[model samples]
Target: MQAQDDFLKRIEKLNEIGIALSSEKDTNRLLETILLGAKELTNADAGTLYSATEDGQLKFEIIRTDSLGIAMGGTTGVPINFPTLPLYKNDQPNLQMIAAYAAIKGETVNVPDAYEAEGFDFSGTRAFDQKTGYRSQSFLTVPLKNHENDLIGVLQLINAKNLGDNQIRAFTIEDQQLAESLASQAAIALTNQRLINDLKKLFEAFIQAIANAIDDKSPYTGGHCHRVPVLAEMLADAASRSDYGELAAFKLTEEQMYELKIAAWLHDCGKVTTPTEVVDKATKLETIFDRVHLVDHRFEVLKRDAKIAMLEAKLAAMQGGDAEHAAQLEAEYNDKIAQLDDDREFIRTANIGGEFMSDEHQERVRAIAKHAYVNEQGEDAPFLSDDEVYNLNIARGTITKEEREIINHHVVATIKMLSAIPFPNHLKCVPEIAGNHHETLIGTGYPNGLTKDQMSVQARIMAIADVFEALTARDRPYKEGKTLSQALKILGFMKKDQHVDADLFQVFIDDKVFLRYAEEYLDPKQIDDVDPAKIPGYDVGA
Candidate 1:
């Protein structure tokens, strides 16, 4: 009855360990759990877990020696200094080493005593025992085989201890059975975990590839796709670590953090649909190419026409012997040239869009458009096309209203694209988080126009990151990257305008996420000192 009860209890523990293994998500923790669970069930004093490597070797993954209190790898941060044991040597399977032999043959090798064991090299184990003044005995080497019958790793436990007397002994047949069962469960768990991780990595790579395609599509946004994720992760991390106020209770699980990061990476994936010409427009009169050059040529034509008329009038005056009229004609021609030069300079300045285009500037553009020039077909036409005047008169930045609309449409397209993807449960919020970066606390933002109350904190964190990256990015086409203080001030104003989450912004400032990211990605020259107290919409006390 006593023996039966002991076996039943061990069976129960085995079931518990199986459940734990299957449920475990993190690879490192899962490995540790498998090794530790196997050791506990078998009552082993020391053990090592070796994962199969692509280079046909058994790599040390986790090592624990209970009696000697030695531990390395698996979140201990102490690296395994031991070299990998080759599974193949001399163009064949390495059967001399017991662990390598187990992995290669896909069989369990239970040696009651290593010193007394035959048919395998125990020199390395003997040396380890000699160096540490420890006795190595009773090895239960189990091969972790996946569903496909392939050996994924080897689990070897050393020095099994008697549960009653605490004396080292050979592993019981029950112990071997339990370890094999656990190894089977662990293999399944590990294989599933690796598959999940590989899929995730492939998915992330696909997302980044899409982002790169978009970034490469527009030369102006060269690194925006890459940098935003770094910034978004930083701010979200800062928000997660905040210990007070609205975000005091806010936190991100490892999965949630990964979701946010993936969201940030795919945030602009919709920009693929955006026209490269509009996205790359650096000057107001830019399209497939800058039309400012065309305008420049037209001004030259006007000047040449003026010179021709002046020379004709002078010749006629000279032939009629009107010397004074000829002299006045020369003065008028010089003044006309001066006026034309001024107009051309104004138009050139207008083409390079910056700041606000005031009413006066718009009027001047319209008036200049009325000037006549010979068209390409040798017919007279307006010096500036009406469309060119409209583009040149853009109130701010380079793109006009229609082009701006086209640009804004990208966020909508991004949402559409991301929503179409069937992300897993943990990642279902990816579309919301990625697409809502353009949204505001108020309803003024684009696409869905989701207000702060309707959006997740992750999305709000994204807004702060996106805006801040834009402000600090040195690679934008419209403007120079702002100084640290200038960026903070602008972000502060955004906070005041209800564009960003005030709580996250305060955390962003208080935690100095900006400084952390700036040190890494910002231009060294743009890294000016920031005085947080003067930030426009920030609450220093809060």
Candidate 2:
């Protein structure tokens, strides 16, 4: 009755260990647990856990020796310095070693003592015993195979001690059976962990590929997709570490951080559907080509016409007043050419989409569009087309009202695209976090116009990241990237206008997250002096 009770108690302990193995999430911790649990169950003095490598090698992953007080690899943080043992030497299996032989044959090898064991090379074991001044004996080597019957690795134990008298003894048949059962459970748990890790890698790769595609679609946005995630993470991590304000109590688990990273990478995925011409537009009159060139051609035509008319008038004047009238005709022609050149320069300047197109500028564009010039067919046509005038009159940036709407549609598309996919429970908020990057804090932004109250802190963090990257990015040809002070001042104004989250912005400044990112990604020229006292909407006293 006493023997049966001990056996039943060991079986219950094995079940508890199995439950612990299944719940472990970290690979190193899980491996450590498996080896430690095995050692505890068998009362082994020392053990080594060897994992099979893809290159036909047995790599020592975990090592434990109780009497020597030595622990290496796994969660110990001390690397296993020993070289891996090859599973195959030359063209055949390396069956001389006990661990390799057990892995190859899928059988448990029970040796009463290393000194008395046969059919195996114990030279390395003997050398180790000599160096450590410890006697090596009673080996139990078991092969670990997964549910698919594929050999995962080998578990080797040395010097099993009898529980009654603490005497070194060979493992019993019952000990072998229990070890085999625990090895089987450990194999399944390790396999499941590897599968989960591989799936996570695959998912991350898929999203990154999409981001690269979006970036590759437009020359101006070449590195925007890659850089935003870095900044987003920097800011989010700083916010987590903040010790004051709304973010003081904010925290994120490892899983939450991963979800935020995924959202940042896929935030602009909707840009894939946006037209490359619009995204790449550097001038207001740009489409398939810059229509400003067409306007330039019209100016050249007007100059040529003026020269022709002047020569004709000179011919008539030469007959009546000889040299004087002919010279005056030439002067008039030169004056007309000068006026045409000035108007052409003005129109060229307006086409750049820089300054605010005031009423005076609009009037100038309309007046230029109304001037008649002779076409190739000898018919009168406006010097500037109505479409060209309308495009040149865009208030700011290369994007017009219509093209701006088209660009804004990308955020809506992002929401729709992300919503269509069924994300796992951990990542269910990705769509919301990514989709609300463009949303303002005051309900003035596009798409759903979600305010700060309606959005998550992650979405707000993304908004700041997107805006900051845009302000400082040198890739866009339409405008020069802002200096550090200029960008921060603009961001400050944005906070004042309630366009962005104030708490995160404060965290951004206090933590100096912008400086950390700028040193890595910004040009030296873009880095300039920043004064906190002068920064708008920022409380320097705080």
Candidate 3:
């Protein structure tokens, strides 16, 4: 009856160890638990765990000698200096070493005494015992096979002890069975962990690939997709460190940080659907090529026509013997050609977009469009089409309203694409965070036009990151990158317009997150001095 109870108690401990192994997330701690549990169940004086490598070898993972007060490897932080035990020797299975032999043969090896063991190499064990002045005896090596019946590693316990007298003894049959069961549980747990880690790596790699593809789509916006994530993480880190205001109560765990990183990487994923020509539109006349050259060709044709007319008048005057009339025609031709050259230069300048194009400049483009020229069909047509004039006279930027809408559609596509994915519980917020980067605080931004009340702090942080990166980015197509003070001035105006989170922006400035990002990504010239007092809508005292 007592023997049966002892067996049940050992089984109960095995059950508990199995639960512990399944719950352990850290690889080192899980390995330590497996070896330590085996030692406790068997009352072993020492033990060593070996993991199987892909190259047919047993790598030493953990070693513990309780009686000698030695613990190396695993969670102990002490690396095992011993060489790996080879499972093969000279291209043949090396079953001489017990741990390697067990892993190769997929069996539990029990030796009552290592010195007297037959058909195996015990020379190393004898040498180890001699150096440490410790007896090496009664070995039990069990192979850890997963659910697929494939050996993953070997668990070897040395010098089992009898609890009654505390004397070292051979491992009993019951001790062998308990260790085998625990080994099975540990193997499955480790396998699950490896699968989870591999999936995580694959997912992160896919996200980065998308970002790279977007960057590659346009040379003008080369690093915008990559830099936004860096800035978002920086601001998030700053907000996490804040001790007052709305952000003070917020914090992120390791898992949440990874979730945020995925969102940032994929924030502009929808840009894949955007037309490359529009995304790379450097000038108003840009399509397949800048159409400004077409206008220049027309101006040259007009100049040639002026010269022809003047030569014809000179010929008529010579026939009539009227030299003064020919001279007047020459003067008019020269003035007309010079005026055409000036108009051509004006059109050329208008084609280039700027931050602030004057009303006068727009009026000049319209007037140029009204002038007539003969087309290839011999029909009279406006020198510049209405469409050409409209594009050239784009009020403040290179893109038109329709093109801006097309660019903004990327956010809508991002939400649609991400919403279709079945993210795990921890990453459920990824779609919202990524989709809201284009949203603003006052419900004026698109495609959802979410207000501050609808958006999370994470989404707001992404918005600021996206905007700030655009302001300081040197790789944009439409305009030159702003200096630090210039960028801050614009951001301050944005704050006044309620385009970003007020409290978060304050935390961003107070924490000096802008300067930190500037040092890493901005050019030396774009790092000009900034005065907080001069920045519009910024309260330095706040």
Per-residue lDDT value at 137 in model 2:
93
Candidate 3 or 1, higher TM-score: 1
Count of residue pairs whose backbone atoms collide, per candidate: 0, 0, 0
lDDT of 1 by residue, 369-436 (tens): 98878877999898888899899899898888889899999999999998899898999999999999
Expressed as tens digits, the lDDT of each residue in 275-301 for candidate 2 is 999998999999999888988999999
Better of 2 and 3 by lDDT: 2
RMSD of each: 1.5, 1.4, 2.7
**Order by lDDT, highest first:** 1, 2, 3
TM per candidate = 0.97, 0.97, 0.91
lDDT (10s digit) by residue, model 3, range 1-542 = 98799889889999999999999988889999999999998989999998888888889999999989999999889989889888899999998888888988899999999988999999999998999999999999999988888778899999999888979899999999999989988899989988888998899889899999999999988898889889989988888988757887889887887788899999999999999889999889888999999999988877887788799988999899999999898999989888888999988877788798889988988887876677778888889987798899898778988898999999999999999999999999999999998888888999977899999888999999999999999988778899989988888888899998887788778888889999999998898887888988877987
- lDDT for each candidate structure: 0.91, 0.90, 0.89
What local lDDT does model 2 show for residue 448? 90
The lDDT of model 3 is 0.89
Candidate 3, clashing residue pairs? none
Q: Per the 3 Å backbone cut-off, how many clashing residue pairs does candidate 3 have?
A: 0
